[model samples]
Target: MIEKINLNNILFLDIETVPEYKNYRGLDLETQQLWEQKTQYQRKDEVSAEDFYERAGIWAEFGKIITISVGYFINKADIRNFRVTSFWGEEKKILQDFTNLLNTHFNGAQHILCGHNAKEFDIPFIARRMIINEIALPDKLNLFGKKPWEVPHLDTLELWKFGDYKHFTSLKLLTKVLGIPSPKDDIDGSEVAHVYYVENDIDRIITYCEKDVIAVAQIFLKLRREDLLIEDEIIHV
Candidate 1:
């Protein structure tokens, strides 16, 4: 954790997603119609919903999570070591396993779930997917009755915004500007759909996802005016 936050109490997470179906044709006609109706604001007059279907993963209704990578801190001798774990493969199994981990280890009033752009995107996307998958929302993901001060979600993007609602920054951009190492060394989000649908490689996406988790954690440290961790301190679990 950065600042007053407990190191172990903060769980840094990032998700990788793809359209629920590989392509537009894979969706049933009724579902396609619904998708078209849902994207009326975003779809251009020249672009049919089918042409825009690949982008559905960005929206909760049309996409499924492929991976959820999380990281936490392990402080040792003035150095903070980060160990990350990932859940991928079947979306339902991933949601179940992630929820179990949250329930077992990070379920506390003090615990927080931190991500870049999480408040508007990741957290809500996860909740929406959990609903679509028929999984119960874990305590950290559910904010139904919590006051603003009680909400434990921390967003690096929001922190960077500093109450500037018009400001929107991507994780990659934040890491770069904040002097944290870029997480897109292998593949970026733009290529994720192609890599998942055409290459059919979940491992690649996992790697990218894990890198984002690490990047988010590092960005948090930077925001707190703390020193960055060396390469040896980053560990994979």
Candidate 2:
């Protein structure tokens, strides 16, 4: 049986993104259409690169990452500490600050970065933006260079795939299945861009990110209890 991973070594993270430029909505629409077409023809079951690009563009323009929320459960402690750091002014500075904080706080540690759909979206998106800004990625973020199973990463979506892979298993859905309460009553993934752009409310974005972090932490707790359990009855009796 797999041993229960110590939650203290894991960092649950979530980011809020915005578009890079104004008037990019039309471009995003066209890209989405092309992505759908390509996916319908090529992968058939996967989202196309164009779709990814469109979402990225929306995030770059309308989705400005106003906040990055991080959560970690302290070992042998009942309290869980979290921080929601805001990135307001320049995108480059924001990314640099986030990266610097990661390096300063979590460098050289054997950390398992956890998030929802992080393997397919969050991690790649953050890495690409960091590269664009010429920021050096921390050692733990270098998952592309590592072997698939060897990567120190945990995506809750992948864990959910053990039972169902075809359906849309959002964080909300997974939390429900695991008997974890949903903390997303304020905002959601769809309204994130709108809040960042139309409302210009960075706090809303940060709140959404905080909810996501909690969801991730809850998912980690469930995974540890269910997938990493060792029954003494089977071994001793």
Candidate 3:
């Protein structure tokens, strides 16, 4: 199926997320109580809710996207250049900008959204955030009444599994196992919330997110049995 699809038809993406507030103390009293209650089972007396707050980004309700970096391939003089752009900072702006990109460029049956584990995490997170921000779901992201084949999304991890539903793979691990370049050279997902909230370095997060997007694109190419694109082949948008 990947072999039949046009390389340029895929819009590859990655997202960086953080807790809605800087720290657990930043949450309001009622919301803090709710967060505590929601995480009780998972915390299991092993950690306090405040300690577990670092992982709030995994939940759409308690977190917000910090950056969404997306890339697409285009041929220029027989050289394929992967162009990337980012929508970042405020969640509303990020969603709005991403929405505009989908509506303007990738809103078609021929276009697809692809990422590592995106179908399970990134895509769903984006959809939930869109609803929370009151933005209309872009056609590609909306799955209402659509059959499985009709879903315009591809997950690299899922493709690698080839129907092995019991296995779980992380992007970092998959990239290493497949001999792809590491996207986590600077910082991994675990440090994102701290980097954003305490260090106040959003540019770092954007860079990390962009690398992940590029890695996703590369992994997709590898899955299609295509040669990898080099650094010179990347064009920043």
Candidate 4:
């Protein structure tokens, strides 16, 4: 099935998210209590809610997407180029711009959205954030009544699992094993919140997010037994 899908039909993507507030104290009393209750199990007895707040971005109710980088293949004159772009800044605007991209270009039945572990994280995060922002779901992201096989999504991590449901692999690890360029040269998911809140470096984060998109695309190419994208073939727009 993977071999049947055209590379041009896949929109490779990655997202960076941070907590809704910079600090746990930033939340009102009611929300603070809610956060405590929400993460009770995850935090357990190891850490306080304030200490655990940094991970809140993993949950849609407590976080917002800062950047969503998407890449697609374009073949002209038998030359293939992978173009990557990012939607960022205010959460709502970021989501709206991403939704516009899907609704406009990749909404066709042949188009698909792909990422590493995105079926579990990026896709659902974007959808929940869109709903929170009151933005209508684009056909590509809307799974309201779609059957399992009807969903136009691909997950590199799931593909790598090969029916071993208990198996899990990070994009960085997968890239290393598969010999693709690593996307974690600078910062990683654990540091994104600090970079956004303390370092005030969104540009760096955007670069990181775009690299992840490129890595995801490259990984997909590897899985298809195709040649990896050359540096010259990757364009930022």
List candidate 2 stretches off by more than 4 Å: 1-3, 25-64, 77-89, 163-167, 226-237
Candidate 4 clash pair list: none
Cα displacement (Å) at residue 63, model 4:
0.6
lDDT of 4 by residue, 1-237 (tens): 798888888999999999999999999999999999999998869799999999999999999899999999997888999999999999999999998899889999999999999999999999999999999999998999999999999999999999999999999999999999999999999999999999999999999999999999999989889999999999999
Measured against the true structure, the TM-scores of the candidates, in listed sequence, are: 0.96, 0.73, 0.96, 0.98
Off by over 4 Å in 4: none
* Ranking of all candidate structures by their lDDT, best first: 4, 3, 1, 2
Q: State the lDDT of candidate 3 residue by residue for 121-176, as single tens digits.
A: 89999999999999999999889999998999999989999999998989899889
Looking at model 2, residue 150 earns an lDDT score of 73
Off by over 4 Å in 1: 77-79
Per-model C-alpha RMSD? 1.4, 8.4, 1.2, 0.8
Summing lDDT over every window of 10 consecutive residues in candidate 3, give the lowest-scoring window.
73-82
Question: Candidate 1, residue 208: CA error in Å?
Answer: 0.6
What is candidate 2's lDDT per residue for 1-237, written digit by digit as tens?
Answer: 114566667777777775554333445676556545544644435765444443443333223455667766544454444433444557778778767767876665566788888877777777777777777887777766677777777888888788576855888878777877776778777676667768877777776777777778767767767432122211110
Q: Rank the candidates by TM-score, best first.
A: 4, 3, 1, 2
Residue 106's lDDT within candidate 4 is 95
Displacement of residue 40 (Cα, Å) in model 2 is 11
Query: On lDDT, who's better, 1 or 4?
Result: 4
**Which has the better lDDT: candidate 1, or candidate 3?**
3
